[model samples]
Target: MELRHLRYFVAVAEECHFGRAAARLHVTQSTLSTQVKALEREVGGPVFVRTSRRVELTEAGELLLVEARRTLAQADRALDVARQSVRGETGVVRIGFSGIAVLAGTLAADLHHFHRAHPRVELHVTELPPAAQVQGLRDGTLDIGYSPDNGLGDVGDLVVGRGVRTTLSIAVRHDHSLASAASVAPADLEGENLVVYAADEDDDSVLDRLGAEQRARVHRVTGTLGALVLASAGVGVAVVPAATERVGLPDIVYRPLRDMEADVEVVTLSRPDELGGPVRAFVRSWDRAGRLTQS
Candidate 1:
């Protein structure tokens, strides 16, 4: 039977008086009677036994009334969930990030901001390299990506936002000669053994800029802490984002790169049209916090 039929049956069953039920339901007594009669036929039995003094529910009416209320309650909940989803109050957002984002505490901060605002929404966070993050987004496995600006300055398919721009610095042991210098330049890397974190493939560009002899001394590592740990032991100069100064490793001192522009940016990436409302809201939240500049 239609939900309206159940609703009408419920009203009449509760009031126990057809006339009063019709008044409560904003319908005339004759119309209410006709509707109830239609409901009785649909149910293949009498829902009410009417007498001159009052109306009493049949056994089937009592059972149907209980089930009808439960069904109505479930329908209400379904409507509420649908509305909440549309408003971005509930859903899932999958995010992929790199080591630098974690080292800078940017990924954690963004997660806290979004979770506080939408507690019911599920956030799945993953740590991945820049290439993996890009691939995941393209393959529909990830909704958002926090990547370094190695070569993702312009991706034709994905929407990119500049976020957490930082300068490059070289971490060195306290006893290293460049550690005491005012600043280290690209030229200053000449004889130093290089420990580069390939955060966004920028380490490749750094290596390409070096001479053949210097390239032979370059060591590549993927993790931020791994590079810094090596630098602390005097393995080599660790090239990292200047924000790494926050790390406060005693033996490792970060010296800014002279004449170098802002060398690293934690970029925010998303599929332009495929993003759900919650994911877009998450991005907008960061934009409002001034953490991202959308291009």
Candidate 2:
């Protein structure tokens, strides 16, 4: 009838004596007997046979004892798992990133630090365009994302956890005319083919700022690596975050664009009320890294 009833029944069945079972259970013999009687009544049968000298289990008592032990063990395991989840000791974190964001070290370092600190938590990282990252966050395919700060209009349900200022720059072949300059201006690209990641017309992307004539000369590349490969082959110039310089593409030089800057934001789509320990730790680590960079 109740968990305690099952417990008392099992203890009585194991000890086969009223007084010893009562002592083991820390209950009076009368109380234990009463509970066992309640269980037997609930099951519509006598669970024990009593004699003046001893007590022994009936057929139903043996079967019920086995099931009761299993049920209690399962309950204990369930409680342990729930506590672990609450403490952020185990779970999965799915992270999404835009192409240029991966070129930076933020995504890679964050994953490294998070795993080092919480090894039990599984980390899954996916490369996506900024728009696709936002969509993934909205649809629950992603838990967190590193994407350009374009207001996240379509993903209005997502929250911007933190942001870092990223500078846009041009990647050109070493022999290109502008590669020798310390910095370049947007107008310097007037006649050159520009390779960029594809985006929707309504998106507030850096490419949107280029003039109509510059847009006309632009070519859409499939991915970040492709853009760099194209630039290395002298197909066109590639625009990417200043951090991308660390990617170490040989024969390709990275130069800052004087008039353009990009901002990257970390986004979380879950309800604010559900903020958990792991997510908080991740954001704190990100902010600390950003501060170190500024210093």
Per lDDT, the best of the predicted structures is: 1
Model 1 global lDDT (CA atoms, 0 to 1): 0.81
TM-score of 1: 0.82
| TM-scores for all predictions | 0.82, 0.77
Tens-digit lDDT track of model 2 for 1-295: 6778888888888888989999999999999889888888899999899999888988988898889999988888898876765676677777777666665555676788878988887778887766677677666677677765543455545555444556778899999998999998878888898876554434335566544265766767535777789999999998766666777878999998886444344333332333555555555565665531211
RMSD of each predicted structure: 3.3, 4.3
Clashes of 1: 0
Q: After superposition, how far is residue 217 of candidate 2 from its true place, in Å?
A: 2.2
- Misplaced by over 4 Å in model 2 are 14-31, 41-44, 51-55, 154-156, 197-201, 208-213, 220-222, 259-271, 275-295
